[model samples]
Target chain A: MAQDSAEAANQRRTTARRELIETQIHEHAARLFAQRGFAGTSLGDIAESVGITRQALYYYVKSKDEILAKLVADLTSSVVTRTREIRADTTLGHAERLRRIAYLTVMDRARDRTRFQLLDRSASALPPELADAFLEGRRLALAELRGVIEDGITAGEFRPLDARVGALSVLGMCNWVAWWYEPGPDHPAEPIAEQMSDCAVAMLRSEPTGTDPLAALATARASLDQLERQLRIDNRRG
Target chain B: MAQDSAEAANQRRTTARRELIETQIHEHAARLFAQRGFAGTSLGDIAESVGITRQALYYYVKSKDEILAKLVADLTSSVVTRTREIRADTTLGHAERLRRIAYLTVMDRARDRTRFQLLDRSASALPPELADAFLEGRRLALAELRGVIEDGITAGEFRPLDARVGALSVLGMCNWVAWWYEPGPDHPAEPIAEQMSDCAVAMLRSEPTGTDPLAALATARASLDQLERQLRIDNRRG
Candidate 1:
């Protein structure tokens, strides 16, 4: 029994060390990939940056290919997993669930900005099968969001619009967080996430009856005309 | 007078030929940059792809640096210029102007997907000053969009929300077209732009005075509860 416990403890240490090494490699590689284009960055560069020998680096990752693939796979699976968790919560309403999903996507992308940027810009560098999987993963995420929008429409919680278009718009809005978000002492991720959630929900909500956009424009135009006329009259009086 | 006319005609021909060559070089270079990345692609590769000697290529463009700069500058100027035009039109209401700006952004991005992709992915490759300029141009464009949103709110044409957030959300929704849009015989830029414009407008329109998002959710919950109660009563009766 003591021998078995010792073996289990050894296994745990190995796993923990593996995790630490993988993370260090990824962070270093991502910085290199960002500074130099992915094509310009090499495994040797990553190893040198990580302060490890190439052979030691090989123990953590077989190639630069594996690191990117792992990064993209983790990004995809985490999105899928988190989205499912939000979906499985029966207590939340459809709109609230959507808000959470939108917020989560923006937050996740913001927190892992470098990883997502690599995923976006360097996706072409991935191997053929890996590229295909990455695309499929994105397609699945978009489809999931579309399904939620459709459900909300059916539930009378959302306006009836093209679900595909809505999903794309929402995803685009959230995905852009990776491009411009920066963490600062004064600015926190929570507020940005909440703001995005509100905007997304605003986009999907059903239009109130009797509020035609064109009609609203017409009203605004008429009001502008009246204001202009009144200003002309005042100018004449002066 | 005859000599001057001849000189003018010769200048026109030279300009036209230069334009043609520049277009060819840009198209080929953009493809290489997209496929192999900016750092991976070299000027010699571009010249070979363009079927021109490297020296001849220099006559059209000083370097690849100039090509990318021209592309980014053109993109920024076009967006800034177009947004200004939309803003200048007094006949169109605020929402209509906003819609056109949104539509134009998406359409422009969709039509020039390759150039836009290069601009986005190769941004880091630009000289530091160039990168700063590029970011500033983007900031100006977003601020212009935000100004329009603020005008709409002041005019009482849109619901009051954080204009900065609204602008970012709209721009994000439109910028994403570069990532996924593919032009085809059946899929035109117009419809996609229109759909996105509609979505953006939908996101900004004033909610009906009587409708509250949270209140709506509460009502939905109550209705669900009533349905469950009715089902229970029917089951007991049976």
Candidate 2:
């Protein structure tokens, strides 16, 4: 039993080491790809940047295309996973869920801004299968966002609007952060994410007058009651 | 006099024809670049696609880079022009101006979706001067957008928020149409533009409760007046 356990622990260490190296390779590759066009970048350039031999780089990735595919897959899968989690959370209101999803997306894009920028510049050049996978992932996330918006509208948490457009607008607002957001003291990711998420929720919020007729009436009644009390005090003074 | 007039009219016709052919070249080059990418495309390929000889293509554009530079210039200049006009229009309220600007941006992006997609994929590869010009134009438009949002907040038409973030969110919402919008009967540009513009306005609109304290107070006063009248009537009946 001791021998078997030792072997398993050794295998786990090896696997972790491999993953760490692969991640380093991906990071170096993405930075190089962002600075130099993917076509202009080569496996040797990435390997050199990662301080590995060209042959050693082959142990982690097959080709430059594989690195790009992996980057895109990582981005898309994370989006899908995060959005799916938000979509399935029953404890949160639709508006709150949407806000959380937008916040997470903006944060993710900001964190991986370089990779996102590389993808933006090279997505069209991706091979058919890779491109399809990336696009499918995006479509899944978009659908999940739209579903939340639809639920919000039905539950009267959001204004009645085309859910698809609303989802796209929110997605666009968050995704565009990849293009423009610079992580600096002046523009931290947290506050920018918060602002973007708030804007997304604001886009779908129902107006106060139309959100709930009963609520509006009650508010008016309460205001009138207070005003009447003040008027009586003024009458006594007169 | 007759000969001079004929020469002037002939010069006008030549200029018009040259302009028409140049537009065609740009359209074909943009489509090819979008499909094959900037690096994959060649001047010969663009010329052949435009049904012109390489030499003739040179007459229309000095090089492929020139064509790309013109495309970027056209897009950026149009954005700067339209937003600047909207910024200066004193007749429209800030919200209306913002809506109009968003609407026009969406419409413009939809119209040039192909070129915009090409630019998105290849902008990083642009030579420094061209890229600088494009970025400067974008910055100008963004500043105009931010200015409008600032004015709206000052005027109490919009919520007090980071105008820069608000402007970027709106800009992103509209620019994203270039990536996803398809011209079809089901998704006409006009309606989509309207939806996007309305969303932009919604993002910045002040809540009714806070938009105008005086207006809220007036509403309360009107409700109190109605309630007092009803009470008097009930007292008379008793």
Chain B TM-score (each prediction, in order): 0.79, 0.80
Candidate 1's C-alpha runs over 4 A off are: A1-25, A37-66, A88-90, A210-238, B1-25, B36-65, B127-129, B210-238
Candidate 2 stretches greater than 4 Å from native: A1-21, A36-44, A52-69, A210-238, B1-19, B36-44, B52-66, B210-238
Residues B5-100 of candidate 1 have per-residue lDDT tens digits of 999999999999989999899889888887776778899999999999999988888877787777778888678878978877889999999999
What TM value does chain B of candidate 1 have?
0.79
If you assessed candidate 2 against the hidden native complex, which CAPRI class would it receive? incorrect
DockQ leader:
2
Per-residue lDDT for B1-238 in model 2, tens only? Answer: 9999999999999999999999899999999988887778999999899899999888878888889889999988878888888888999999999999999989988998898877765665677788788888889989989999999989989865778888999988999989888888787888788888998998888655534455566556777687789679657967
Q: Write down the C-alpha DockQ for each prediction.
A: 0.19, 0.21
In the range A10-117, model 1's lDDT, one tens digit per residue, is 999999998998888998888788777677899999999999999999888887778877877878866777777776787998889999999899888878888788
- lDDT digits (tens) for residues A1-238 of candidate 2: 9999999999999999999999999988889877776778899998899899999998889987778778988988877888888888999988899989999989988988888877765666677788788888889989999999999999998998889988999988998989888887556677678768878888898776623545455445544643454344333334
> What are the RMSD figures for all models against the true structure?
12.0, 10.8
Give the fraction of reference interface contacts each candidate recovers. Answer: 0.36, 0.34
Shift of residue B58 alpha carbon in model 1, Å: 6.9
